[model samples]
Target: MSLGMACALASACCFGIASVLQAVAARAVEAGSASGVDPVLLLRVLRQWRYAAGLALDALGFLLQVTALRSLPLYAVGASLAASLAVTAVVASWLLEARLSTAEWAAVATMCAGLAMIVPASGAQGQHPGPAALRWSLLGLALVVLLIGALAGRFADRPRALLLGLGAGAGLGVVEVAIRLVESLTSSWRGV
Candidate 1:
């Protein structure tokens, strides 16, 4: 449990810092040169040191997240990941030199409070092998998300952010489910 908690926290911190770095790099790019969803923007961002660092952090975060997911319940892992927003808020204030209003600080506190409540209630990952139907459903969902993201490529920045954010959230959710599914499969294989 302690290791899981550590991994989760590490994941959150890495993701938070990465987000701020990536955002800063993206913002530095000139506007009106390319669509928000353009691959060229990614190429441009990659030229920035901040973006490259952010990508490295993202890779580290993903490993930590997987470690956490293996040991903790999906709910616990999910909540911790969601709490990355609070980490982002802090990182933005410190590294990005952004001011946090009183209300924003309170919101971060609220998020921490909520996480405190969740961690205690969370248990070990369940042993049950979820239904095959669920796996198929998740696959379908992934395909649908890819389609939506492709379509969103034509959209402007504001709408593109919303769509991409939603897609990313969904992708993370799918990762949680996939972890559970893998656990179930491993358990079943061991039983055999």
Candidate 2:
């Protein structure tokens, strides 16, 4: 495998492992009295070793992701990132002693298969950098995501969580596209 693909997979692994650690830490902590999204609870969770480790891994994963993006097409990189769910399931089963249903196992297998198929098909990235309009759109999307997040606090727990998840997913997409738009890592500020 190429170094870029390897980096993508490693990034996925880091993210997957980080997710489990964060979940464990989040679950272990007691709920705070804050009515809305509790910033204080985040500070509290930061004290947990698992959570801290998870954050560190997330940072590493992001850096590795950028490295992967330098060589791999965005589609391949996105697939690799999605494949992190497989890692998460396996790690969760092992570390948390959680049993996976047959369906879940099958899903994980499918994700792996999809990623395997994508790797060979994902040739080199195209030469075209994203247009100025696309960058503007990303900025617009960012604002929309921020707005959604702001309004999400009004919903009950389940709906709020769902809204936040959607917003975060959109935000991630913006970042992914923005990374592709940037021509140079050194001039990242101007790129974004």
- RMSD after CA superposition, every candidate: 2.9, 2.7
| lDDT for each residue of candidate 2 in 16-121, tens digit (9 for 90 to 100) | 9999999999888887775535668898899999999999999999999988988898888988999889999999999899999999999999998998888788
C-alpha positional error of residue 144 in candidate 1 after TM-score superposition, expressed in Å: 1.0
| Stretch of 10 with least lDDT, candidate 1 | 30-39
Q: Largest TM-score belongs to which candidate?
A: 2
RMSD of 2: 2.7
Off by over 4 Å in 2: 34-39, 186-192
In model 1, what is the error at residue 88, expressed in angstroms?
Answer: 0.8
Which runs of model 1 end up more than 4 angstroms from their true locations? 32-39, 155-161, 183-192
TM-score of 2: 0.90
Q: Over the stretch 6-42, how does candidate 1's per-residue lDDT look in tens digits?
A: 7998899899999999999988986544434455777
TM-score, per-candidate, Cα-based: 0.85, 0.90
Clashing pairs in 2: none
